[model samples]
Target: MISLVSLLVAAALVCLQSGYQAYAQIEGKNDLRDNLQPNIIPMPKKRALRPFINIAGPPPESARLIPGTLLELSCEVIGFPAPTAQWLKNGEPLTEFDDVNEIMNIHPTSLARLTSKMIVSSAANGDVYTCVATSGVKQQMASTTVVTVAGNDEESLFGLEALFRKPSKPIITEYYNEVFQEIGTSILLPCKHFSTSPSQVYWFDGDEKPVFGNPRMRILPTGDLLIPSLHWDDMGNYSCTVKNAYGKDTVETFLYPNKKQFFLVTVN
Candidate 1:
């Protein structure tokens, strides 16, 4: 009976060992398959970007005018992504007023675009105006024609007519006299000294009052004063005075309205 029991125990032990081996083999096969296979995790993708933007247009030129005169401004621009348009006066945004008018425009295309216009009266003279444009994440800016207002109307008949027609103030050439000649004669005053600063050249009759301060007179490219169609009464004592933050200096010359006159120059 004891021998029978021993044989049964050995057989049972062998069966248990075989079952353990089979289970271990199955687990190893699963681990190997997991390492050899690619991971099933999902990854994110990248996106594209938009293009750059640009703008182009004509800006306003310098402006001069008589006080109380009306002013009008027009501006246009081109750009990409369509731009926002606005106007500024003296670096400040412009608003509608009794003496002012403004217009804005925009267009659609691969390249966006804009246009603006403004109008103001003479009281608005001597003031500066600017136009600006903006698009999606982009912007552009431009200045309008600088408008200069005219001075008082009280002036000599000879100079007054020039002021009304296109009167220009005489620029101070130096603290010295300027020789002027008859209407048809050519006169040259050395303006090299006056180019350093913008000064006022006052033409006065015997009373020592100013004859011209308006824009009727134009500054010639050569730095000489050009009075287009001279008259017998145009001659007088002309004084060029420079005024800056530092101080002031005056130069005077005797001129004959119809004859050519040249004066020696001295600057202080």
Candidate 2:
């Protein structure tokens, strides 16, 4: 009986060892198969390119034109994913009006070219024009040009050329000479002018740097400088220059901050 019990215990131990070895063999095969399999990693997507403007053939410079003559203003721009163009007169979008026509031509390509044209029956003096090009992901770019219309001299009884030869100087309005405002306020510096032909308006800082086409600073349709938010650093001398075919005039103004009055308080 003792021999039979020992034999049974040995047999059970052998069976357990064989089962464990078989399980180990199966696990090893699974690990080997996993290691032999190919790994698939997803690729990253390509990014789209942003658009930009070209330097060539942007827009014509300031033109001295005659009244009742055909005026053609053209602008060309290039960018990726195509770009749209718009025309603005004195900071306002221009539309087709009586005696005025606007045309836009777009060429599709990898790098697209957009052209805008504006034809006026009779160009007037003091008309500020700009062409703005915009894309989906890029900042808008613009080009500005000023037009001066040639005025006819009534006293000249000779030829038509002599009547339209004289050019007039710019005359800036007097109301915008001095401006006073508190901090964090807004102000508009009027720079309106009168000329026999169209004139261009420009703004300069105290450091004589040109100021226009900024988010905070803009030239209004009436040739006024619009400063949306005035800070303490904005207190300085500013000048507005208006130029025409004949001559240009500059008017300077000083911006002053309003004084803050302080009152004494007694301790309670």
Candidate 3:
């Protein structure tokens, strides 16, 4: 050894150089992520998810009605998953075999549907009518006419014509000519049927087009028209057309400003 101090100094210098080499080895980047690209996350699509369970429907615009009359209940609904349907009357559930109840059909895709006529008879004359449908997560509801008993027998009853008659027709057993208001007051036209065929009846306004009653205008089971309120336009020559396999018949009436007879009123 040249000298003990000289030997120690040489060892110290070697250690320092080794440490420097290790530091210099990481010259380009100290982190591995420096050369890597950032990752991007994809977003979800903006479409309505399938199997949506939601009720879709509206209650009937009217409820009060006469016994033996037919009331219609309808609704439209969309479901992610299809749902089963159930009908109810007076809170009691209904099935296919339920008497006096029928289902027309569900839509082609089965998203919407209609209920058959809820015939209001003496049994249901004063009972409430309702329809309810249930799906996996959705429920829909609709209502039927109110059962009102007419003050008169002629205006309180409704009957269907025989469906098997070769020539079908609707027959009126009673006729009442009453003038309740001025030119605008609507009149009730009661229609009855006694035949062997399905009696298809049509009501025409003054000009022969189908005449549908407004909320203020009501058609009773006995085929009587009820005007909740009258208007000048309600005055006209109203007509009732009945058709069946046997034959067809038409009835006409002239309503004026007052109870004035058809020929008695002076036309302007």
Candidate 4:
């Protein structure tokens, strides 16, 4: 009976050992499975940066300009992404298609500069000009300026009446006698003159008929003519006449398309 009891005790011990070994193997396998699985971590989302304006040109003050002169308005900006610029006149956007003669120059950078230029005209007087900057972030900024055209009366009021008191023979101080431009491009026929009185200026085509009332052609208040878009029919001899009470002066110029050479170039 004693031998049988000892054998039963041994058997019980072996059963306990086997149960512990099985539990350890199962726990090791579970740990290995956990290690083999991927540990996923979520990524953070990106945010958009806002744009800012650093410098705006053509201050709020009235800009006094002589007719036929080039007027430039500029705006400078900085941002994470570059900004685009647009010009507005009298609350309306000015585009290349508009009768308004203007050109835009945009410089590339995170900090960018945009410049708008137009030949001054009598119609530009008393007009409000604005420049707007925009970015992809749905935010925009703007700046404004007022234009003032200097007339003979205004110049006289500033104690310069003697300048226009007596009529004098008109003298062409600055002119382009010949120019070669590309088709569909714009050109400026400069005919700046010097006279004692306010001169009456007119432009004539090759046929000698007065060139007026055309949307594409404009006589700037300063006696210069602007051709917004050049065409084949636009090539020919052009004459500019300035008259006053005392005398009159006449000058002629020629235009051609797709010609790279200039015969006579005069600048003032």
The runs of at least 3 residues in candidate 2 whose Cα sits more than 4 Å from the true structure, single-residue gaps closed, are 1-165, 259-268
Shift in Å, residue 60, candidate 4 = 44
Q: Which residue runs of candidate 3 sit more than 4 Å off their true CA positions? A: 1-55, 95-126, 152-268
Clashing pairs in 4: 67-222
Best prediction by lDDT: 2
lDDT (10s digit) by residue, model 2, range 94-213: 664311222222222223344445543344466667766655546454554556544455422233344346555755532233344555655666555555588898998766778875
Of 2 and 4, the candidate ahead on lDDT is 2
Clashes of each: 26, 7, 30, 1
Q: Where does model 1 exceed 4 Å of error?
A: 1-55, 66-69, 97-110, 123-125, 152-268
lDDT of 2 at 264: 19
Rate residue 170 of model 4 by lDDT: 59
Tell me the tens digit of each residue's lDDT in model 1 across 144-217.
Answer: 55555344434323343553455223223221132323465433322212222344333443347554563434
Q: Which stretch of 10 consecutive residues in model 1 shows the poorest summed lDDT? A: 98-107
Cα deviation at 139, candidate 2, in Å, is 47
Ranked by lDDT from best down, the candidates are 2, 4, 3, 1
